[model samples]
Target: MTTGPRGFRRALNRGIPRRNRTLVALVAFTVVLTAAILVWPTVAPLTGLVVPLLLGSILLSPRQLPWFVVFLMVMLMLAIGRQQTIEVRTVIAIAILYLLCFIVLVTSFRRTRLGVAGVLGESMLVDLRDRIQQQGGIPPLPPVWLVETALRSAGGTPFAGDFVVATRPRHSNRLEIALVDVSGKGEQAGTRALLLSGAFGGLLGALPPEDFLPAANDYLLRQAWAEGFATAVHLSLDIGTGEFEVRTAGHPPAAQLTAGAGRWTVHEA
Candidate 1:
């Protein structure tokens, strides 16, 4: 059966922390070497040997394999040198090959980082959101059910039609929902939208419209470089009172529909 790296990761599952320490060390070493190469290219030839050394160390564990591969690219580039070597055609061919390889490597690393960040970020956000809702001093009588979607939509293109839903407590009850169209799309948009949905869901229970708006504003400002902010609305209706409270935070106005009357209204918050 397969052993080695699999065995090591399994052993790590048995409560040993040293395996994690080793992985961190290897990653840090790779980052340091990459930085050194970029900042001090004069010494690049010497640091270039780190690629093979790192690869040899990979047999010690599986976690650092990607870092070693990256180091290999550094080594190859340094070997090519900046002083120029072959003909223009040969140089062009080599550059194209290197570009293709770099694209593949970077894309793979980015996807991996996204998956890891999703797990850890989701966990931390869940806890922090719960705490904020609890502190907001006026949670909804019943918890709201929320739905989050990746910004990819059904097709493989970026779209801003992301949405969230909050179901009332009873099966026969009406639902309070929020459909937010973020300012951007793709990974960055999806991540920020998810965060905004969670933050709004939690705060809708506890804070007033003004405070909630500013809170979400500050959150998004920290996330993106532009002046963009979410345009969202909070909608809720009382079963007995038949009244609603609608809040907007730079988001689009919400649409309300009545079943038998066939009348629709776009709310302004």
Candidate 2:
């Protein structure tokens, strides 16, 4: 088994996720700086640096913030006790610290619009993913054929770069479906996927078959994202005649399952 400092460090590393490392580092820095000022009161003006550090509270959860705030209060009180003659600069620094802390705390409290979580918290993202699922729901297919679809991102997350939007427009026998793969690999892209899914679902049936892809391309272009490129396949099918047209933009060919041969074949766009 593992022993001592190296092993302890390894265990600690495993305890926190990569995203939270910055918070842990800042907390350590605050403690070390506080100790330094306690030993050398001449450096008390440096406490203002802590105010800027707390600005990181924007990314911190409510409960996680108290650690920094409480410790900061203790550090300030200690500095006040140690410094006999507080300089003008030191007084200004303390005032700025108090103002900044108050602002950040207020901002954190106001973020309670989600009741418990932030407005763009994980819960909100999950809700968006559910909406995307609902938007991608295939309309009631005719009895003769079975249709199945699968969408999962890398590592099997609820968030994915790939999404589908489908609809059978009112008074129309045609079913229009679009499978879009957006660029990027994380939550930001997943959120974008949900938003695009909504936009594409509306455009799919509302625009003529020939106009849909161009309209979608135009819509995406207007957004002007840096990594904005997306691949999409648009499929339009006639319920009665079984005739269909498949179009693609930077996406793979549509696949057809040959039931008799039990194999998948690619349909050229």
Candidate 3:
């Protein structure tokens, strides 16, 4: 509901998908190994090879850490067996260096990843906010102020299953607004909400008020998704006069607030 530091952290920690991370790790590990092999001849006894290998492993996802560890162990054994003249104390010291390097490199990689992800997520949110503002179809000004909000259960994304679209036709005194709830929830439903918002917003003031519901019904029937039903409330209001017409499709009745009596009344459309 609130966008702050905690929310930014949550978005960053959302992390790249496991499959993509694995692919990136594999590519990075391959490149590091290839480069090490190319330079293996110049580095005698492979005294510091394990450190670079451990650092390379930091590119890998947590699930892939074991594979990298096994590879490192195999390489270490081969290097030790080939260089029998190398001292045991030197081998032990190299192992210690490798361990320290692994710890530091992994910690640094994670922080860097979070930093990059935070920037990426903030950019994505900015883009989404701009698109929603442009395509939301909300009128600049209206006789009545309508407050709309949506809460998503899917990782606090701004998109949701419910949406509102409003428009005031040119050379007309009527204000048309539609509140729609799609069949599903979270990101999946948010997609449908986006599609329907565009379609309904375009059709809202294009036809006479009476034909709006029938056209929307035809559009939905054409979609023909299994168990894909939506509930919508369409309101057409006169700007000068306090008269309005409401149409509902499988939606709950709307409530009216009376300022004179300071009471609320529910009306079924």
Candidates in order have lDDT scores of 0.54, 0.78, 0.66
Encode model 2's per-residue lDDT on 30-110: one tens digit a residue.
Answer: 767777777877754566556435555655666555556666666667767777687798788778877777776676666
- RMSD values for the candidates in order, in angstroms, are 11.3, 13.0, 13.4
How close to the true structure is residue 16 of candidate 1, measured as C-alpha lDDT?
50
Query: TM-score, each model?
Result: 0.43, 0.59, 0.54
The list of candidate 3 runs beyond 4 A from truth reads 1-37, 40-137, 142-155
Ranking by lDDT: 2, 3, 1
Residues 1-269, model 1: lDDT tens digits: 64899887887677657646655555556566655655665564333444444433333233344555565566556555552345677477557646654654554466465443333545665775454333323324443433233323544533223545354434433335445666665445655655666666665435443465567667767876574566766666664556677777667777777769999999888
Q: Which candidate comes out best when scored by TM-score?
A: 2
Error of 1 at 18 (Å): 11
Q: Give residue 160's error in model 2 in angstroms.
A: 1.7
